[model samples]
Target: MIKENPLVVSVGECGLDYNRNFSTKKQQRYAFREQVKLACELQMPLFLHEREAHKDLLEILDDVTAENLTLPPIVVHCFTGTEEEALTYISRGYFIGFTGTICKRDRGAHLRDLLPKIPLERIMIETDAPFMNFKKGRKSSEPIDVVDVARKIGQVLAIPFEEVAGTTFKTTSSFFRLD
Candidate 1:
């Protein structure tokens, strides 16, 4: 199917989500492992989603590596984790994707503080549209809001918006091989 469709660029939005009860651990583990294997088999990038399950996720990834599987590029999307988690992903040569959650007036402060810890080359921006709305009272968002995410990241990192925009755009393009 992936070979038949040129648009299929990645395998994911896959990972463990222990913070939510939407899926059983066994089920999530099965799906995540299958997707990881698929990404490796297809030589496609991986779009991961981790939440309060980094320990398990890391272990699984480590096992895959131990087995000598050639993992493809990985991006942890909509990340809102501790600084330690960010560093772990960075150390593993994976990219991190930030969403509008980093723009909130209050809840975003911690994320802002961690921005400086991530290299521009390892960072990407996303809106997580209709989900991670950061406006003071807004309950939804759109794709254009990724600009707000980049702008806020600039403010937090003491960089120019244009630089942030350019860096994130280049990082994302490179990761997904958009060009």
Candidate 2:
């Protein structure tokens, strides 16, 4: 499917989900590995989703990197980890993608506070469509809602929203090598 869709820049939106454990840990691991392999094979960037399975996720990343699988660029989308974890991934040269969920309370706000600390060059914005709704009085998320994420990032960095949008878009395009 991806090979046929030249416009598709990412092979993922995939990873372990131990938070809800919607699937068994073993199953999640299998799925995550499969996607990683797919991304490597296709030479397409990855949009990873990790939740409460950072240990397993990091282990897999370490193993894969050790194997020299020729990993495509990777972005840990909707990052929800501590600053240390964020730094660990950044150190590996992976980009971080923020979502509108970062505007929410508690940990989300913590992410907001941490945003400015992340180099803009290493950050991207996403809406994780059909989820993480952040619109005023809206109940669901859409790709267009990425604008809100950019806005929030702008507020955190004290920059114009347009600058945030433009910079993130450019960063995402370059990371994915999008045409």
Backbone clashes under 3 angstroms, per model: 0, 0
Worst 10 residues of 1 by lDDT: 1-10
Q: What are the per-residue Cα lDDT tens digits for candidate 2 across 144-169?
A: 88887888888888999989888888
lDDT of each: 0.88, 0.84
Superposed model 2: Cα runs more than 4 Å off? 1-4
| Backbone collision tally, model 1 | 0
lDDT of 1: 0.88
Q: Runs in model 1 with CA error above 4 Å?
A: none
Q: How much does candidate 1 score in TM-score?
A: 0.96
Error of 1 at 177 (Å): 1.2
Q: Model 1 over residues 40-96: C-alpha lDDT tens digits?
A: 888899999999999989888877878789899999999999999999999999999
Q: What pairs collide in candidate 1? A: none
